[model samples]
Target: MDAGLKLRGIVAGYGQGDILRGLDLDVPAGQITCLIGPNGSGKSTVLRVISGLLAPRAGQVRLAGRNVTGWSPWAMLDGGVAHVPQERSLFPAMSVWDNVLMGAYINADRDAVARRATDIAQRFPLVARRRRDLAGSLSGGEQKTVEIARSMMLDPPVLCFDEPSIGLEPRARRTIFGILAELRRDGRTVLLVEQNARSGLAVADNGAVLDAGIVRLAAPASQLLDSPDVGRLYLGAS
Candidate 1:
């Protein structure tokens, strides 16, 4: 598969200290690419750069062969990039249906948004099941499904997820991973940053190990999964 998003010699940081130092990586299109690493490894920072939340101090950000370095979030969204942030981004007071429709807010055509919402609702029954309930009232797993369903409103080609399975029960995590697999089957490019290396690699077509802001290994998911070093470091192998 081709790269949907590419980072070349990326350098970014908050203060004088650079968290990502000359990092280089590619998220392949139409497949799930999981980024696994320890805390403070600049994993989330990479997502921020791709989503236009943080401007890289150096290097380039490319999407679908277009240069999008330093583009605003709106610009990125217009270029078919959808970012599902790590934090709870839904409006708690709004109904689940309303929250899902919020993803279509960028478009001016109200009717088109509604039409798309209908399609999304059909794809995710959870949206219809809890359409009348407040977004905050749902369980964690349900909220995740709603969030993912909202992302589909734009029909984006690329989807970026940050720690998607965080703070969820085993069943919820399984549900989330299954959703990711379904996305892959739909031919969407998925860039996933996951703390659970084992689970992440299990669902990904490609896996890259990041440490101290740079990629230490990039290979097929199976290869990485079979690596003894990787298993010992991240997979909790004895």
Candidate 2:
């Protein structure tokens, strides 16, 4: 598989110390690549670098074979990389339709934004059903669904998700995972940082285990899921 996003020898951190110490990762095109690791393993930091929330101290970030290191968040978005953070990004007081429209903020053409909004609403019925409802009025899963729909405003080729299912219930978690599978089917390259390793890998084509800011293990999702050592160390198996 061709690499949709690539990180080579990444070294980044906050203040004085480094979190990602020479990390290397490749997110393949048109597939879901799940990153699973213990807390403080630089999982979220990786997403930050990819989405330009944090610039790496060293190394390179490549998107579709183009060097994009140190680009701003807006530039990254324009370059077809959309990031959905773990925290809820909606304006609680705003209507769902309004929140979705906010995704097209960078687009100058009103007609194009309107057409994309319509297409996204159709793709995510929750957006249409709650078009007039305040974003805070929706359930956790519903809110997440809207967030994803909004991210599609640009029809990006690469999406980076940071623990998308973190606060949801079991059914909602399933729904989010289903949506992730759908994104893969739509030919989007996804880089997922998931705390729920089992569910994440269940929907992913590849899995990488992060430890001490670098990839400790990289393999097919099925192989990682079936590995007894992996189960004990990362998957929380007894």
Candidate 3:
């Protein structure tokens, strides 16, 4: 696997409360890697650490093996890591097109931003159709789609999504996963932390079960999905 992001012996937490202990994981180039587990499993913390929202107490965070263990939040963005948090991140009063353009605020080039926005609109039709509607006017699923489209401003090589299907209905959940698959088809590394284990694993190239900040099991997503043990424990399947 071509390395897009790597975390080794990573320990992170909130205010002395350690959630992730010695967690090691990898996101290979052009693949979707899903992290699934029950609540309090430190799934979101891993995304936070990767995005530089929270610093890992120990261990290494590497981008293509560059050892970005302790880079600033802003630096990490410029380094090709884009994070889409579970919560809707758009400005409720703003237009969807504007919100998507904001993702490229770090880039000083308007032409480049415009070019990417065009690409994203073509990819995410909501952005094109709802170009003038207030972001808050969209449904939860539509808002989530816009959030993802916004996160692609830089065309980062790696994209990390936290609980992307959190508030979507069944049909919307299916659409969200479809979008994720499209991302993979475009050759982007996607590290998704999802509560919907079945949908997530179905689209993942690799899947890891995270518990108490540790990866309990890691394998090809399809294999893990087929494993009776995983299906019973994580999927609640008989």
Give the C-alpha miss distance for residue 195 in model 1, angstroms: 0.4
Off by over 4 Å in 1: 1-3
Error of 3 at 223 (Å): 1.3
Q: Pick the candidate with the highest lDDT.
A: 2
TM-score, cand. 3 vs. native: 0.97
Summed backbone clashes in each candidate are: 0, 0, 0
Give the clashing residue pairs of candidate 2, or none: none
Name the lDDT of candidate 3. 0.92
- After superposition on all CA atoms, what RMSD does each candidate show versus the true structure? 1.2, 1.2, 1.3
| lDDT string, candidate 3, 131-199, tens digits | 999999999999999998998989888899999999789888888899999989988899999998988
| Worst-scoring 10-residue span by lDDT in model 3 | 1-10
lDDT of 2 by residue, 193-220 (tens): 9999999999999999999999999999
- Predicted candidate 1: what Cα RMSD to the true structure? 1.2
Winner on TM-score (1 vs 3): 1
Please give the distance, in angstroms, between residue 128's alpha carbon in candidate 1 and its true position after superposition: 0.5
TM-score of each: 0.98, 0.98, 0.97
| Residue-level lDDT for 77 in candidate 1 | 87
Candidate 2's displacement at residue 55, Å, is 0.4
Q: Return the lDDT, model 1, position 209.
A: 95
Candidate 2 global CA lDDT score: 0.94
